[model samples]
Target: MSKRIAGPEIERLIQLLAKVPGLGPRSARRAALQLIKKKEQLLSPLAAAMAEAVDAVRICSNCGNVDTCDPCTVCTDPRRDGATIIVVEDVADLWALERAGAMNARYHVLGGTLSPLDGIGPDELNIKALIDRVAGGGVSELILAVNATVEGQTTAHYITDQLSGLEVRVTRLAHGVPVGGELDYLDEGTLSAALKSRTAF
Candidate 1:
């Protein structure tokens, strides 16, 4: 067993911090030390913020987005175009797209993609809700902004099949070389897609 270098409380803090994404045991130890050092400033505020979040955070009933409200701000926003919906794999993708502000449109979160190997299927995700929304009308276009993974593509295909008879136009994100990316570092698939999807320059 490893030697006890700190008190049980501090060790427990490091253990819990390690469970967070991108944080390893060593990183969590460093973070715990920093938090303890700035107990009055950073730690106190962070603790309060976390407590508030636990009380206020809610899962939106409409689009599956997490907010402090039921329908979420996006769903109730009259300024956004309800006719255009960007379907993403998760809330993270939704937030990323919102940050980009690519279009003044609405969004739908699938919760997760189809991963049969991982035992996640159609019913596991929020797909039925999406279909219901489309069937309810007013939605004209559906942009599948899912990742370029096999599971993501499978989920997109499944969603498309479900909406086959619907009136909505389904589109996928264009795969290509990123802005400022050199062609030498790009893979064959990206190069091919970029060439095929070449637009007016």
Candidate 2:
């Protein structure tokens, strides 16, 4: 067994930081040290910000986006194309799509994909809300921007099946080689998708 290195407060900070994604115990210790070193400049402000977020942040009732309001900024924005809704597996995916600045459209976060092995199903996701939104009319298209995993595809297909009789046109993101990726570096499936989805140069 290792000896205790820090006080309870510092040890707790490191423990909580370690719970965050991509941050291990060693990195958390370094982070805790940095925060201690910059207490007034970083630690105090971060604490205050977290406190504020604790009271202010909420899940959007309409689309599952996390924000300070019930409907979120994306759901309330009049400038976005409400006729098209891009469905994503998580808020992180929604943020990634927004960072790309490619589509000025609304979004629906499904919370997660269908994974029976993990006991995650359509009812566990925000799939019912999505169906309600589509059935309410005005939505003309649904762009499935989910991951390429089996669970993601299964979830997408389930959603499509649910909206079978709806007038909305359901589509999916194209699979192919990335913009700067080399052909030799890509796998057979990616190469085949690129060939099948070839566009005019």
Candidate 3:
């Protein structure tokens, strides 16, 4: 097949953009064209920002949160509850829980869940680091904010088992219907959990 293509540079940009999570070839092409058309306002600034991020962004050494700081702002924040830690499956989960603004505790990103079939085990996650933090003995409670999926539950169980001998208490998030969700729209699992966790009104 003859290589029917635009300029090599533009083609390369489109190809790279298409590899992004939510973008496809057509959308990437459109995006690239827009970027080119608005080079001064968008493309150049985006390029500079990408370069700056590449230089500055890093994984936090203490909690596995991605930040420019080695310990991350969350870990270093004195206002946060130093005796409480919320464990999550990923950085995205950490951000989500932060946005909820329910707790002012520190966080530990597990990096991923325990998926034996996919060959992702405890060793692949930040489980040991979490144990180390717990064992060091300042934290009084460790809240497992992992997802409700099988792998997420498995990971939470494993962590709880690891902290069994420690003085710190371990807790998991309560499962129930979402904030705006109706009872009729909920799944069997949600309904069951909501019933099991029912409280007196």
Candidate closest to the true structure, highest TM-score: 2
Residue 134 local lDDT, model 1: 99
lDDT of each: 0.94, 0.95, 0.93
Per-residue CA lDDT of model 2 for 32-117, tens digit only, reads 89999999999999999999999999999999999999999999999999999999999999999999999999999999999999
Q: Candidate 3 regions off by >4 Å?
A: 1-5
TM per candidate comes to 0.95, 0.96, 0.96
Write the candidate numbers in order of decreasing lDDT. 2, 1, 3
Candidate 3 Cα deviation (angstroms), residue 139: 0.2
Per-residue accuracy of model 1 over 38-59 as CA lDDT, tens digit each? 9999988998999999999999
Model 1 lDDT at residue 87: 95
Worst 10 residues of 2 by lDDT: 1-10
Question: How many pairs of residues collide in model 2?
Answer: 0
How many residue pairs clash per model?
Answer: 0, 0, 0
Clashing pairs in 3: none
Cα lDDT tens digits for candidate 3, 44-124: 999999999999998998999999889999999989998999999899999999999999999999999999899998899
> For candidate 1, what is the TM-score?
0.95
RMSD of 1: 1.3
For every candidate in turn, the CA RMSD to the true structure comes to 1.3, 1.1, 1.5
